[model samples]
Target chain A: MSPSPEILTPERILEATEDVLRRYGPTKATVVDVARALGVSHGSVYRHFRTKAALREAVTARWLGRTEELLGELSEEPAKTAEEKLRQWLAVLFEAKRHKAGDDPELFATYGVLIQEASGVVDEHLLVLIGQLAAIIGEGVRSGQFAARDPLAAARAVFDATARFHDPVYAPQWERPEIDDEFRAVCELLLRGLRA
Target chain B: MSPSPEILTPERILEATEDVLRRYGPTKATVVDVARALGVSHGSVYRHFRTKAALREAVTARWLGRTEELLGELSEEPAKTAEEKLRQWLAVLFEAKRHKAGDDPELFATYGVLIQEASGVVDEHLLVLIGQLAAIIGEGVRSGQFAARDPLAAARAVFDATARFHDPVYAPQWERPEIDDEFRAVCELLLRGLRA
Candidate 1:
């Protein structure tokens, strides 16, 4: 069977760790659990991650990285006006978070605990998101679409302002019937604010 | 001894509960602890609060009530222009939250947990705050100081937009030296958007 199919890659470990986390949550999940799922010894997991903390952090980074990649693509999409891009970007973020919260509640709850323990990963993720927003705002400023003097500040403001729709703290409210209307209203106000 | 000077009123019970919460945090705090601090029987506390959950919820509502009263006064200040009121209102919120998070971190941490457990109180607090914002926005629109179709929608947008400055989740960054500058930029952007 091609030497047991070599299932000890970092990617495999992370995937298995995610499963273990989803099953047992962050508090109860362990490297041994991850190793067991992969049919490998705990020593092999240690060889890859060094410690349980390292493995958890890697999982958090990976999860956040997926969101960054998704939003990054929207920020980079050419041809669309900055205004359109900003709207789409915020919409996607809200939708993505809602999906995560709604579609896979078990994994989402696990990540919530993991995030509290991995502030470094959360901070890095915020920086990347803010950077993407700044890039889009910079485009708007240069194209004379937005009149803001500081793109980065503007980006941060936009991020902060729409946080209710995206922040995990308000995740319970995201599924409410009026959430889409509320999201659109906030976006419209922001777009109006950014207009030159 | 002036007939032992009854100090077992509901107000006194709440005060003692707050002390107990500050000392032991939300999870470990109990009505018995509050009674112990107040030098009264737990039965006395129960007579005032009905149940431990009721006591905790009352304490949370009281804590949130202070902020609401503070902001409500600002919204009611008839002399100031809407723009000025909005500026002061947002500034005060950021300051108030920062002070709570900084001045008494132990209590702040306790309240953080309590607030999560007291969502009904929290939701009511948010509604009152938003209602006050809508009232202010309605006045601004009527005075021709701002251009907005729906005062409530505008108010919600403004609240969502400034959440980063005041939301408890971002309290850790509130003490950053540059936060004031960031706050100002957002206010400016929103004010510019609102100007008729």
Candidate 2:
């Protein structure tokens, strides 16, 4: 009789997949490679993900989930002024980049490549991540703490600045302390610009 | 003996390549294809450009030359205030996108694809286009017409915002008037955010 398959949690499989992606980029990260990493057969990997595309999506979802675990705690605090929220939020995002810089350079690069590749597909979960920043901007605008303006564009701009931290070319050259300070200054400038 | 080769002007070759790129994407727009478009042999095309890559670069150079022509004129004109300069500059960029939308759809799309693909390459000339925008921001900041800030970051924000026009998903949906107004508003908001 065929042996029953070993049970591998989705999280464990995802971790292995991320490791595989880090070692070999998206083009080379195959089910066989992932299965080898997990000490499981290819069928086990296939059970969790039907195709490579599905696997890639799951890997990205896993990364976002971790980002949420890192960022989700901030939004729970009492609401604050736009400047305060923007400063704290940019710090949170930058810290995540720093954390990855020390822990997993390849994975960080892989995540960026994946995000850029999937940007047009409109991942709902990623939007939810962005929505937290958007909510802060909305609160600022409504409270008259920020100038009346388009929250979505403002949030996107802030996100873009912070996201640059993930770029190896720019991030290494940049001083984090300076970038954080500039983040505050830039956010304040935007809020003042938006003032009704 | 081989027939004596006829020489074509660099200007004439670039024009033919642009026409070919507009008709077909970079991958399909081979030297042979360009030569056929110009009614010359592929060998003649090779005599002018060593490879397809060189030809593609020339095509991109031609596109940038036109953009630079407009930017050069705008830079020389004095704006009384940072806000006015920012708004007028946004209008100029959006107007260029609008003009391209009418004239050469494939060329614009291919340009975007090539730029994105060549993003990290040192020889990529996309930076020259962005540098012009950065120079304007730096000049504004130095002149004290703009806020004391990181001109590079501010420039990056403006470029990111302008990219909305280049998005394939949103391009068809874009209303010229709405984009022009939106760009103007966004630039005003950014300038406000950048202020001292």
Q: Score candidate 1 by lDDT.
A: 0.87
TM-score (chain A only) of candidate 2: 0.74
For each candidate in turn, the TM-score is 0.92, 0.69
CAPRI-style class, candidate 1: medium
Chain B TM-score for candidate 1: 0.93
Please tell me which predicted candidate would have the highest lDDT against the true structure: 1
lDDT digits (tens) for residues B1-196 of candidate 1: 6975775787878888888888888888888888888777788888887778889899999999999999988887678898898888888988999999999887888888888888899989988998988888788899999999999888888888888887777888888898888888888888887888
Interface RMSD for every prediction, one decimal? 1.3, 4.8
lDDT of 2 by residue, B1-196 (tens): 5554455777789988878777888777778888887788999888878887776776766666677678667766763465566667667766676667657777667887655444344234436655766777787788777764677766655654455543333455355455555555556666666666
Evaluated at residue B53, the lDDT of candidate 2 is: 76
Candidate 1's DockQ:
0.72
